[model samples]
Target: MIDTARPPSVDPHMSSALLLAAAVAFAAPADDLDLTPGAWPMFRGPNGVGVGADPLPADLIRPENLRWQVDVPGRGWGSPVVADGPEGPTVYVPTATPDGTQMDVLAYDLATGEERWVRKLFTVAEPDFTHPTNTYASCTPVATRDVVFVHFGKYGTAALDTKNGHTLWERRDFECDHFRGPASSPLLVQFDGLSPRLIVPFDGVGEDDQYVVALDAATGETLWRTGRDPEVQDVVPDLRKAYGTPVLAEVGDRTLVVTTGAIATDFLDPATGERVWRVKHGGMNSGSAPQVLQSPLGVASDAVLVTTGDAPTSLALLATDSDLTQTKGAAASDPALAWSSNAGAPKRATPLLLSLGQAVTVDDGGVASMVALGSDVDGDGGEVLSRVRLGDSYWSSPVRAGGTIFTFGKEGAATTLETGVFRGGADAPPELKVAHKSTLDEGVWATPALVGGGLVLRTEHTLRFYHPDGTNE
Candidate 1:
């Protein structure tokens, strides 16, 4: 559990409460577990901290240097997200049917490639519409030491024992149009001294006011439920739908919950569902993750970074709430907005806040560039890492480990670069690149899952693993 801030509200323009809770659960490939070391446990990983201790080879890994590939059952766009469980580090994979009807959750041993268990956690006779490029498993699963939770939107949510595939409990009554089927993944964090809390964001179809839910991870009990309305279910375009996930971070001793979706990026109280402050980015659709970085505490209590724009000029920066309450028109207008950068921002992929004040962005057309982090970036004068054409359009957020950043082409072409200051060791030579890479077939929209010194790459048809020492099995 993390100790939140103990300060009072500097501004009270919004409500104060952590609205979302956890949903859905998944299993990894059918294999003995051997997760990539220092891997991701949930979306954006534990506490939404993009910072990782991943021991990636300074050199890139190429596809021709084959490791081991395993065809996964069913199909999905969700990536193989991993977590350390009672069974050591295990991989939790959420899968969907080709027709997008049947959704399955499989847990695999991270070591030897073997199916630990595959449980049909939930099924929707009919599914909400998702992009053809999207998967019914768009949202990744959330897990703790005891159980893994999966959010299947229209199909409902389920919890499974990490040791075996036994479902500990499930709640299938939650309903959401998910506009394009749920893409916001579940987030886990310690709250009120209990087991880390489960936070889930639910965005229905058009004009539907989205809601955030909090749940007890062990018993599947509802703790709190907060939304954008007093209970408005209208389907206009007031900007209520969202595809982005919620994140938790403390500011000045207070536990502030930040959720970035379609219309608004709101800040709430982690202890309760109270809106402290909120800023409306006012976009029709948003598809990226929110990251909080070290910065001066004021408008946002911290610098909150997000990506927007099918074109450049679509990015913006705003603050999260310090207080939690829905009653607004209060004090502190617009909260705090450090700044927003529209320069070369990724339209589909979430931008990476890199080292040395630089942020790496990849456009929908596969144009990659490293831009400065300050909101006042001129976009004219700065070091341009690479302006070359890469893969087809991409949805996977680039991965940064140590001083190197890794972005995978939609076709599974992995590109690694050395960013700012070295967090692990001295910057490796530019000659060092992606040592190994491969693709199952189709483009991999699902982000790669890192755990236990192993990387699990998922395509629409198969899931593959790459271990250290250039050996994969």
Candidate 2:
């Protein structure tokens, strides 16, 4: 059980005006507060869905498309998040010193790729062992108009003013071993008439330590904490660790916080942090967040598509208005499972939902497949439409911009696939064509942010901005 007794340290530099603005922003209707063109609020953009409206060029490696490249001071695999500031759009990223003694959040001018501010939030005296491929700063930041929430797993979690990088409030007492390092990003949930909450998942290897905590967004006070069910905690310690992030799902008028853990995916009420339902799956060390599909399989209800960790399969849990629990362990006969497929299921990358009633998933080994979502709930859905081998490995999830899906490989390769049109029906499979393939000089583990009709990518050692017709001027 993590401690939340200590009060958050508030920065005096933050003014009341900014706090009031945050209140007003959260008070606005959800429709009016939809993600704008200038913001990439969370890990994979709004709700971690990894879809954007900007248009990215096919030839991203062309010199003419290189807007600006700046060398980042430290190392991290966290993706960059963008939000509108006073001057313009600013990019925020987290990084740690080579020795892991200092972890900081660096802000940059999105337009010119210039350094804006760097604020050190944590100093670890003795760092724990992390996987060679993972880092202490693997968690990305969530941004609002006025504040940006950053989490460094057990190191700390804080809210910073986006204007001047002032720490508004910080809570540093949450403890977790994070056996492989922290990768789950924080999620901000705001309702029409309820107080805003920042939900953080802590699925560690420690005994009886798997739980989710919600904090008051404005004050950094603990709102509620809910633990993973005891049945799911019976697994081995190594198998209990997870690096996945949580996503919000809208089921009719109710909003549920859907989180994927080692052996189970739990759905919780966003307001009370209480478990609404739990579905047990077969895999451990789950790293990919679940993707929600509305009117899934042409059904009137919504469904959640989840990837069992480190395995070659995925499961779809149909969302319903009633409370239901499925602990039968990834069986096809489970009443909660709408469908299950073993084709191109990702171990790291989150599956991308296409507009043509299809889902695209690229496994860590670079095999991308398109699965046709059938029209009815019968046995026809979850069929593999196509599969392509790209000959690369990926830790970063892919993002879709316009009609192109951009996949960033672990060894610096970028592949763009042009998704062709498909007529509505179960028989018509969508066409996927490789548009362009390019490799960078450095490795890329972080997912890029697509905003303002451009891209902000973080490589192993630097940050680079790209635009379709950008110049070095």
Candidate 3:
């Protein structure tokens, strides 16, 4: 149920004012520096690591604390993105009908949950088939002050004017099968002296037909395209597909984009789409996005960590070495592999990299594990610090805010734990203490958006906002 009572702190007429102001400023482009402090502007916030400075409500299960809950028109699995607007703040998400024919991008006023605009951008006569768990609107929207980009896999990809909800450009030339449906989300990379580019992976089931494409963000022109050949072993060919999103990592003074495909993970130069290094993992069809671990002092490690997809899931760690970095071939037998653990690898949700040098992962079965990065310790890397069971099943990825780690299950339950100690010696075990628990009526599959001292969570049929006390503002 939703609380109809209006809060005294916010004006009810603010929604209309926000819409008007947003319309006037739709022509200007937004950058990372333009985002508000609490804004979550991308897939995993700005950095794509699911970390925020503000804390969520300790008890979101309480109905009274829910600020508002409004029914959504269609189904979607993509997470919402928040940005600062002219009047206040705005939220954007993509949804589609049950038949996968109609695709729409909806924008809402962050203050009152008022629908600002809905743009019916594309309609497919013969839509591709998707798995029962996936929806037609699975890809999340990427937004800036000037425009918002929405992608429906091979169906279509378009840029919409942020102010009036108008289509700026459209592209449908990319060839991809998306055997079980597309899951990779589009990413934006801003360059210093060049136009900003949108990067997305096209790893479909193929023999030699995979590509990592980069497009000019302003005009939707192809800037560069590079091939990706995982050379997967003989198995179900459909398993040769991947549904993971690419992430940006800072290595020394250079920046690289790290992407996981069917049978391997590759690091490429963001500007030219050149391969920096490649590491082969045994699994096929990787769904979890790769995470670059950071040390306690805030330095990013050269090694990247990810969970290999499919049965008998394993966690693989790949680091840059002179020999492997110099060669363009796959590093299946490279000596830079720190460790491989098969304990609790997730197939869908992305892992959380902690500031305390611990990597927290939640598998599809709702089992959570904390592993030490071994940067400060003397033991072999990839040691399990601790483990716990949160729920029966989970699809939403875990996030960190303030000093707490939040995990959500598919059955509407959420667990809050205090970040475990990161400086424990090799002999001491890492531990995360449970602090609070909460729940909702509908199940969750999308990651929640946190900003403006509040949280925006999307269930199967509703979008709800909450205060820190789990109460409506």
TM-score of each: 0.79, 0.87, 0.85
The clash tally of candidate 1 reads 91
lDDT of each: 0.60, 0.76, 0.71
lDDT of 3 by residue, 1-473 (tens): 11213221221223544423322232345443232222676777776788876866556446776777778788889888877655457788888997888888988877788888899877888888888899888787777765677787877777777666787667776678787777778777764544476778877775643677776676565666777754553546677788777888776556778888777888877777767666777676676778876444242345678777875477877755334333424343332555667766788888888766678888899888887665421226677778877875888888877777777778887787775445576556658666787776778889887776777888888887766555434
TM-score of 2: 0.87
lDDT of 2 by residue, 1-473 (tens): 11224333332333555444333233333333323323688888988889877766777656579899989888898899998966678999999986678899998998888888889888989988888888889899998767788899888888777767777777776678788888888888876655677889988888755888887777666767777877756777787778788999876556788998877788887777767678776676677778887764453446778887853346454444232213323333222655667776778788888877788888888888888755444436678877777767988888988878888888878888877644456555676678898888887898889887888899899998888877657
Sort by TM-score, top down from the best: 2, 3, 1
Candidate 2, residue 116: Cα displacement in angstroms equals 0.9
Shift in Å, residue 430, candidate 1: 13
Error of 2 at 288 (Å): 1.9
Runs of candidate 3 exceeding 4 Å displacement = 1-38, 233-235, 297-301, 321-335, 376-379, 421-427, 469-473
* Candidate with maximal TM-score: 2
Per-residue error for 201 in candidate 2, Å, reads: 0.2
Q: Candidate 1: where are CA atoms >4 Å away?
A: 1-39, 63-67, 191-195, 206-209, 229-240, 296-301, 309-313, 319-334, 375-388, 420-441
